[model samples]
Target: MASVSRVASRILVPFLVVLGALLWLVLGAVAWAMQPPTTEQLATYLDDASLAARAAEARSYGNHLMRPELLERARFKAENLSRQNQGLAPLDPEVYTPPAAWRGMPTTGTVKVLAVCIAFADKAPVTPVETIRSKLYGAGTGSGFPYESLSAYYERASYGKLHIEGEVLGWYTTSNARSAVTETTAGREELIEEALDHYDALGHDFSQYDNNGDGRIDYILVYWTGEHGAWASFWWGYQTSFWATSYSVDGKRLGDYSWQWELYSWPSGSYTPLVAIHETGHALGLPDYYDYDGNTGPDGGVGGLDMMDANKGDHNAFSKFVLDWLTPAVLSRGRRAVSLAPSGEQPEALILFPQADGQPFGEYFLVQNRWRVQNDTPLPTDGLTVWHVDAQTDGWDYLFDNSYAGHKLLRLMEADGLEEIEAGGGADAGDYYRAGSRFGPDTAPASSGYDGAASGVRIDDISLDTVATTIGFRAEAGPGGLPTAALGLLLDE
Candidate 1:
């Protein structure tokens, strides 16, 4: 991600509050519940020219949340890790190369921290290094090294931009590592327990600390492996720290001090910086945006390319929501070290686009009619309205734009929580916007179908037919990060 000028601390506290609340809601909920398209036309719609332009966005979102491997990597980072103190004492002259990017970023009102590794021995150790160095630290030809890729990841992720307030801990394996290594595998239970203990023991006191001493850590990236077998490799602190690079023992990861990058990779196999950064982004509360559809779209269809999608499809870039959510954490954590300009401000409004021709709940909502916004002072601008050219003043009529933010901004704008408004202004029109895309001006241009206005627009939540406009409609601008502006729906009202 590139450096942004947005500074949260300087903006109004409300901006932080709103942004924080939304991010917490979205990030905390990993159980994404997106409905798949069932109708052919709708699928075709997603494939239309406009949607196609967002291929980068799709890939970015997919990479952030969908890619299992990247998510797994993030899971690794989220896990707290520490080694059992063996007979050995903490390494002296602690090799600490600061995260170059974090050098000039914001900080939370806490102490800033950076993960430091000290598992490797001094260089040119052909002199038989023991205790920590072994045959396992070298790389194999073509197979790749462990730490190289990770180093690149740190550089790319921070790229001297985002701020993180935690320090990922890493140390060499103690005797406990030998004892636990029964057979070839360490067993999932053992590993899980160890990791839990590591985190539980270390705690987050330092995790959230920034240079300024704030108590909020948004992200901490760490990766290292302990001994797993009777005859395993020694942990390389520097020079691929914990990596088994027996392949070409590149002096790079072995605490060479010669290389200039701040963070070094800990693995022996080759690593890609992009993958590492992608994984780290997840730790900060982002989700995947792309998909490789094996069941639909087309054979070998990964929809399009994006970072969230595995390399099997596409990679790179970040999504709008990803950028929005992370921005707050970065600012709150004090990544923007400079004395920022001012104080608080918040996103004017949130949006909700629920009613659509297709329904996730079978046919129940497929043909209902209702467009709702809170009934604040702005009325249609704040309150709900029909879609398209409704019987209202705004040609977008049934469509709404609260003109400005409302008091009940999100008190109830979700599909399940939308309040009903009066439709068609009739006794039966009762209270509810005409849903199902029924009110669009162009919907029933000239004649009506035998049943009524046979328009592509269809009602979503409204029950009355006389007030219902059978036009196709899609909700826009939601607090959930769905693309509203791009989708032609006004959500902020």
Candidate 2:
């Protein structure tokens, strides 16, 4: 009887265990099925994005952690260090401070570029690196703008602060003196790292280089020490500007500045300031003009003079479109608007509207657009187009709009000089924002479709970057009904 009782107890226990396991599984399945994914969380991993205002405050946690650098050269007090010849001198002042509007931020004062002036070299490994200073905030060098004289060009373009010269850090020749086994690439890389250390010691500020003063820096100039073959590039870098934390690592850097260069020219056309300044315009949010406005550019006449056109001589000029976009934002930091219109003959072009984008489209790059006077009343003496105005400001820039991707269709044009901005209709079958004084509230400003506007492969799809604010569409009523006009914007001081 005892054995039988024990057997029954064991059997009952196993059965209970099985039942409990089954019950738990069923309960979990039920709970999961009942709950649904939330909208915000779901959108973070979306395959399709129809409507978006671009993310605001578009910054990463990394920016706060990033650290820029400056060198403090004290006469090479060390006896042994001086023999290596580290006394070439860095860019003048050896430190960079932002303009007053920049709030006393210590920006990346020096960019370390590798100038292979083998001409200056004493021998192998001991390559005499020419530390070419990057042009200051306002140095015109693209095949020389067609000004009557270089002085006239500097006086007009540098905003009269012409003497501000850039720096070339002291040159550091490699030591072929080391066992012949050392690789040139490795040596070059080390020199670059050392140069970075000099700046790192001084502690540079990322925010100061932000010409627009947006919380996030939009542009950076990265000077490289020793790259194998590539010329100093303005576009590619550590993307350090993407995150400030990058600087926490020994080799990390943010390529925030616009102008990049080697100490000298790589090829015949490489050394000119054209590439440096042209790239700077991009850092400031200008687009390629060769492809803008439905015109296959590198256009004739003054068209080629714009940086977007890629002309050696005149290609470095900024377009009016670029000026309107950045003028108020950068200039307004210290100065007040002299007036909307420049002096003489009603000025060439006028900034009708300016708006600040919250973010997601990265501050204002995709948030605004500029319109130029293509044809003034009988055509003003200045051949004014939106691009024309930008050049007058002594800058390099262009325009672009590609919001036709990943959404529905339509946009609105917020006409300037108008008292009321009206949205013709609310969202029904064909409702879009109507005319208003620069994208006022109470109207649907612009929109796109499920698929973006088609450009070739590289540009076929619109990226989810912060540049969308200025690239959307404005839908309004036309002869057919609802019509869309591409959006253009500029910064409002």
Candidate 3:
């Protein structure tokens, strides 16, 4: 009886163990079946993988703009750097201070420009006073170019909020014998002083055009009557303007005072009058978008896409938005689709790319629909133009210049197909987004897409419908993540 009982116990124990194992397996299957894969989960994975791949690519190119480690370091500097004695204009209570010191705060209104056309050469022919004045005010039209074009460019760029008004103080005969090439930085400054003196000699009050009521001229546009080049345009580095003390038609100190002065210029047909517009951008605190060294770093210095970089310049959406000329339609979280009108068309719409995580300015991206127009005639094709702007990287900041890809304020999205075929070596068609192309984290691995995700803005299905004369796109947060408007509003305060 004992043996039979033992046999039964062993068999029962084995059976019970197998039954428990089966039950456990059944429960596992049920759990697995109950929970299906989620869209959020898939998106998260994709975002991660995409970001990882982008990180590797950025590492290969030393792209500090996108690298996580570099970004953290930048954040630390922005927070810890002392603003005291920085010479920065006092921050307005309402102005938004971005994480990067470069962006600072945008201060825009009517740009008051004082035009001084100087005859740099003794033989330099006198360009008509009306011609100079008209060019400045967009009066007469010719190949020499209309000065008003510069103002119109700003006016249209700002949507009329920031108009560039100026008076050509006529042609001032400079006593400086230096040609455009021979003029030293110091000499050019002295020439500027001499030119101002010439204006004074004519008995024109320099104080009349002080539009800002700041007791100083906001900007100076000097058109020297000779071949103009790099030397022709620049912001005077020193704060002490000779004009502050007294004005001398020749060159002498008249008073003991100090003031800040910024100037830009153009040659008389050395390049288009549009060159003035480019230099004027500098006066507005924008930097060159082109690779100054001429090395095509990463994307070819935004490659003839922006006015700051090329002659057939267009006021990129990002630049306009930064200058407070145009406000972008902020695309927020959970927002999917946005319909946009052509920049040339009515009901003009500009879309601001979502901000990056922990970034003060989030490498701002502004989108504007582009088609051939009077000012933007150089567009290779009709399509949507996406502008990548970094306000955190100052025009003067050289440390991050190579890392930031030339420290250009306005970088273009060179997704346009024609860059390779049509525009040729001289032109840049890369930054334009044509119909059916998508740009975002997923597309970053491929060179075909714009590096939009690098700036924390992902764009997709950017299409242009010629029939409707409208452009459409879907924007979402990129890998780095974007701040909510509510959150940003609070932070801004």
Candidate 4:
């Protein structure tokens, strides 16, 4: 009887242990299945952290003029004047495409800028001159928290192809009071001319500032002290009066110039370089990504996810490509699989055309891997960011009052298919594509043309890893597959 009892106990103990283990596994699987999806988790995190709110605050203080269309038209006229001054034939009004240099400042090589610090007679300067200098040209090893200077931002955005080397000289008092200069366009113009004359009297050779010898200086940045005045007093970039009237100093013509407050008080209490970096983008010929309609329109533009939009993060891949700093791999037809390094880290990106023979500058899509690193640290999330671009449309069409009346020149193709951004939502974690996600004709925002025709372009199996994001592409059948031999086509000369 004792031996039988012991054997039964041993058998029952082992069976009970095995049953407990199986029960735990089943409960674990059920709990996992009931939990929210990864996207939901990401959205919750972004909300709890107030990432979107921070972006909104950064955007509240507008960076450019309310009427950017007028600026572009003025720029066109100025470019023609610069060409004629350089003894080059003026760009034909009918020609949409011209030499890259004719677009704006030189896209390649070192660009020498003249930065002048101005103080209003009424308001005192806030940031010191040396601090502004460090913010502009300092290597990442500085006292400032960002450590990334304005020059560093451009160096990274341009993939080292373009360098910003310049001098920051100022604290030069404006003769007029803050209210006087901020009152009108003519007043601001007089202030700029006053500062240039001050430096010119000091024997500063203005001719050396013209880096490209195109009869114009590369750029000039005026850092002014005090709170911005009215909407008219907001920061902006424009060609100096000479751009229209052939204005010159010391035999050098004034070209593109941007004026910004010496410091911004949002997100950071101290002076930061983001606003300066953004205004410089305008100097580089890139337009603002924010909606001019004040979110009253269907879309709020890019929703502050881009540097040119909310003055946050690094420049988007499309901006770099426009400046001739990035060359994307073109996929026009058939099926292909490729991996893209983080665009902020590498100059690599992918371009897809709806039609096999579509022009590179025409309607197309740009895909890039955006990771939250370096200057992109402010971004809410990281994944594959897609942009819908129609270079055929004038950039001024992005303005609300402009009569161009079509799709925006550039639009962020949100992965969540919510069009929340178009509904005036700020950028959130759901805006990007992650692993297992697919974008094609079958998706909510179908890969279609503005005319509502199905575009054969399809992006599938987007997978993100620590190294890079890999994606597969498929195009509708065409006469023949694009030449695989010329896979590396430069977008611009």
Residue 323 CA displacement from its true place in model 3, Å: 0.5
Instruction: Summarize candidate 1's per-residue lDDT along 1-493 as a digit string, tens digits.
Output: 1111122111212222222222322112111111111223223433442222232322322222222222222222111110001112323222322223222113112223333222222211111222111111122122222212333222222332333323334442223533343332234223323443454465534323333222222232333343211101122111111122221111111110100111222232222232333343343333433221211121111111222322111112122122321121000000111111000111111112121112111100111112211101111211122212111112111111111111110011122211221110111122223333222213322112212433233223323223321222332111212121221121112
Best by TM-score: 4
Model 4, range 1-493, lDDT digits (tens) per residue? 5554454333223222322222322111111100111233224434454323332433443332222432343335434433432345767775544443454566678877778888878877877777777778666336433325888888877889888878877889976677776545556667777888888899888887788676777688877777643222244322232334445788866766776666533122466665567667767766666553332333455765776655667888867765667766666555666677778778888777544344323566778888876666656777888887755525543332110224566678888899866655566678787776677878877777667877677777666676543333332322232433345332221
* Top-down TM-score ranking: 4, 3, 2, 1
> In model 1, where do residues sit more than 4 Å from their true spots?
1-161, 165-168, 176-220, 226-272, 290-293, 296-304, 310-318, 325-493
* Higher-ranked by lDDT: 1 or 3: 3
lDDT of 2 by residue, 231-254 (tens): 111212212223233342233333
Error of 3 at 300 (Å): 1.8
Q: Residue 456 deviation, candidate 2, in Å?
A: 32
For model 2, the run of ten residues with the poorest summed lDDT: 26-35
What is the C-alpha local distance difference test score of each model? 0.22, 0.24, 0.44, 0.59
How many angstroms is residue 212 displaced in model 1 relative to the true structure, after the best TM-score fit?
15
Candidate 4 collision pairs: 242-247
Give the TM-score (vs. native) of candidate 2: 0.32
The alpha-carbon root-mean-square deviation between model 1 and the true structure, to one decimal in Å, is: 23.9
Q: Which regions of candidate 3 fall more than 4 Å away from where they truly are?
A: 1-111, 142-148, 174-183, 226-272, 295-299, 344-357, 388-410, 416-431, 444-458, 479-493
- Residue 427 C-alpha lDDT in model 4: 63
Where model 2 places Cα greater than 4 Å from the true spot, the runs are: 1-143, 146-166, 170-193, 199-220, 223-255, 258-270, 292-305, 311-347, 350-382, 386-493
